[model samples]
Target chain A: MGRTLTEKVLGRKAGKDVRAGEVVSVSPDYVLSHDNSAAIIKEFRKLGVGRVRAPEKIVIVLDHIVPAADEKYAQNHKSIREFVAEQGIPNFFDINAGVCHQVLPEQGFALPGLVIVGSDSHTPSYGALGAFAAGIGRTETACVWATGEIWLRVPETMRIDLGGRFRAGVFAKDLSLKLIGDRGAEMANYKAVEFAGPAAGELDIGSRLTLANMSAEMGAKNGYFAPDEKAFEWLEGRARRPFAAVASDPDASYESVLACDLDTLEPQVACPHTVDNVKPVAAVAGKPVHQVLIGTCTNGRLEDLEAAARILRGRKVHPSVRVLVVPASWQVYREALASGALAALVEAGCVILNSGCGPCLGAHEGLLAAGEVCVSTSNRNFRGRMGHRDSEIYLVSPATAAATAATGKLTDPREFS
Target chain B: MSRGAVWKYGDDVNTDVIFPGRYTYQIMAPEEMARHALEDLDPAFAKGVKPGDVVVAGKNFGCGSSREQAAACLKAAGVQAVVAKSFARIYFRNAINLGLAVLQSEEAAGALDTGDAVDLDLARGEIRSAKGTFRFLPLPASVLGIIEAGGLIEYTKKRLEREQE
Candidate 1:
């Protein structure tokens, strides 16, 4: 079998023959835990792990239920705080630290040629920086917590080749939705998804991150981009240690390869209850919506906000629709505000949520009631995915969502410009 | 011989309702969690579930939340194996790591009713219930190893012992 990006990383880390379905252990460059998953720390106590193998190798971020939405949640953070203090884990991001994946890359914790694991599914969001990031369960999180390593099966790799350039109204979110639709959710199950092609090369790092972040929704184990100049530029300000690069060899073979031509694609949406229910914007053009949200770890970068702002400029939101804009992190929020994107969105009557997963997790804010409809840029819109179990959610590109919010109907962004 | 009482459930049961977000922060013993397992979808889940019963669900069982609490609760509730058509990625890993058996089979999921008595063959990946015998797709070899070793910690200890030996 030819080496895949996932195999190369796991093999080097394991220093052995890594194969699918084999029980092999490999050290990770970083292990991430969050407030919702800090309960693992409490479980770690039961396992009798003395000191964490390496505090520097671990990252703790408090995002979910941050600032303590309830007493139960506050106590959860308190326990994580206690564990971090006891273990002397040096890299700790608290309620004020912003989203974990966002801050990890921002602070130089993620680097190329390293394996990163987090407690959340969206942890794969960091693959844009050319690292292997996989989301594991809490027990696996605990195993990593105690030993700084965990077992993995070297997954078969599937190559997605992007060609041509995106049209004016299309964005990375549309492309991702299109992939999910063409290939069912199970197509990428337990596989490494490598994205390559001329269109992929033209995309910025943030756009690549958007593509890789949702690979989890397709049931992929790892998603990555090859290290390029963009990766170096992303690492410029936050690193001091020199790192070796890892990439697939020229003749690396893939189990399957899919080619996506951007020039032929249009804005797309994933219908209710399934991310794989993909359709073009023209198919759902006149669908009415009750809410429009434009953010998630996938599309919550400053560029996404800028795109939404560009569409919303000089226009007011429809009376029937509520628009919510959430920046993925505090830094992204600062960039948006500095660039006047925030002003445009606010003037257009869009509600700006804090820099965490506010309405994304069906938490305290922006929840939908029964029978209501929402066009959101977030990943996943399953039953009760957004808020109420009965509400319908239409997953769309940020441009489509913004334009729909402005028009109170599922209008195309091209309609405005 | 089967070791305990039977507790049963239907198909397509998800991980979120098994262990809701509200309890994710609480490290209450698995026993405490068992009391709340499936509370959202079925209020009587805690009361009716007994040790050694198999949960037969349709496709995509254990579909949400990376929290192992859902598995911990099932184990604490003493579910011997989860026989389903399919499983979400995180839940399958969590179940094996927690020493809970998850057997996948479309036939097994289709044949078993909520309260049927069943026998599990871990090695063969088959479930024998009153409805009939259904073959479960084998788990990944790594996961099967962990399950046989009685979860992650024990497997680690055994590996260290062998290394020293």
Candidate 2:
């Protein structure tokens, strides 16, 4: 019997053969935490561990509420700094680095064939690099820090084979929304999803990140793409250490297989209140939007900005709309600026915020008021996610967000194309 | 055995609604968080919930962000156990690590309604109510050990002490 990527990775780490549903304790290659490190520190202290078991394996990034949104957040950051210094942890990215998901990969910490766990649910984003990445609770993270190992249940694998090219203006975000819509939020619960097939090769690293990041929305433990030439090329200069990429055997068993054709896929939008509440761009067309945000761990890369800039170049944003562009990391920000994407967006009346998680998680920056509607490229349109409980958020692609910003309503990106 | 009144909810009751994201960065005690538990979903949940009350919900309960506050707030708000048809993966671990009981049984989730009285027997993996008796697979032994030890913190402490000895 052949082994799936997840079983292979976990089995290697465990120093023995493993299978789905078997719990094994193994030390992970990397463990990430963000602003939640403040809370995690408290839990760590309770373990009475004077020093972290493996400081090198820990990565901390402070970007959830950058520059300290208020006194409370400021104090949290202060404690985290003191903890980092006291513990002598070397891999700490201060406020300016950007979101943890993007920063981890950009800093060369995410590598293939490694088991990575983090405090944030989107830690699966690293799976785009062919790593076995999963999210765990803060207490579990603290325990890992204390013991240098954690238990994991090898998840059943779900194979999603993507074939055919996407239509113009329809990208990976659309495909992601479509998948989540067809399979409800709990469709992949306790499972690992592997993205494969012909069309998977066409997606760039940024698009792969979007798909892997949104895998959390479908209750997946992790999502991954096999490391191909593009992945190896992208990691050549960024990987901190040499890694042996892992892949599923040709005949590996899967809990289920879903085949998706991207040729006819249209722009998709996750309606307000639920990520699975999805509809085609045309279904919700003409709904007025108060704000249009294009950024987050899901879609805040340079390519995302360029896609938005393509639609908004030389065009003014609607008078009733406010467009905010947040690059995923400082590196992406510099690249986008050099590529003229930032210039085009700014010239079109879009506001370029610093490279941080601007308004994706609603910690600060661009909060919405009651009765307001926002069209955002970020994932999760849950009620009160970006501000007022009554405010609405429609999740769309960067191009769709830009198109909506131009018209101050829910508009399809294909219309502009 | 444990017993409580039921506070029922529908499918996909995400962590964002259990504890709003706006308070993610705010440093507050667990008790204070209990005040805002489910404020957006049901304003009465915080004020009316009594100690030992249980939360029953449809599929995909506690879905969304991996913020531990979602599980913390429910534990702080005096929820004895959560019975749902299913739970998001991360939240299930958080609940168990916090020493909160979580039982999965579609039969109980469908039969229980708001205000229904119920008894949970963790040892027998059964939920008894006026509707009837529903059986759920008990948590694995390793997981049940953590809950019995009053969460991961205490469990880790004991392990460290044993190692040092």
| Candidate No. with top lDDT | 2
Query: How far is each candidate from the true structure, as Cα RMSD in Å?
Result: 3.0, 0.8
Q: Which segments of candidate 2 are over 4 A away from where they belong?
A: none
Highest TM-score scorer: 2
Each model's TM-score? 0.91, 0.99
Write the residue-wise lDDT of candidate 1 on B68-126 in tens digits: 88788888987887777778777888888888887888887776676667778776666
The lDDT of each candidate is 0.79, 0.92
In candidate 1, what are the lDDT values of residues A1-417, reduced to their tens digit?
466667777788899756554556789998988875566765566565577778888888887666677777777888888888988888888877576767787888777888889888777777777788888877778778777778777778888889999889998898899998997775677788888877777788888888888887777878888878878987998864576778887678788899989999888999977788899988888888999988877778889999999989899999999999988788899999999999999999999977776676676568789899989988877666566667888988888988898889998788876
* Model 1 chain A weakest 10-residue run by lDDT: A16-25
Kindly report which residue pairs in candidate 2 clash with one another: none
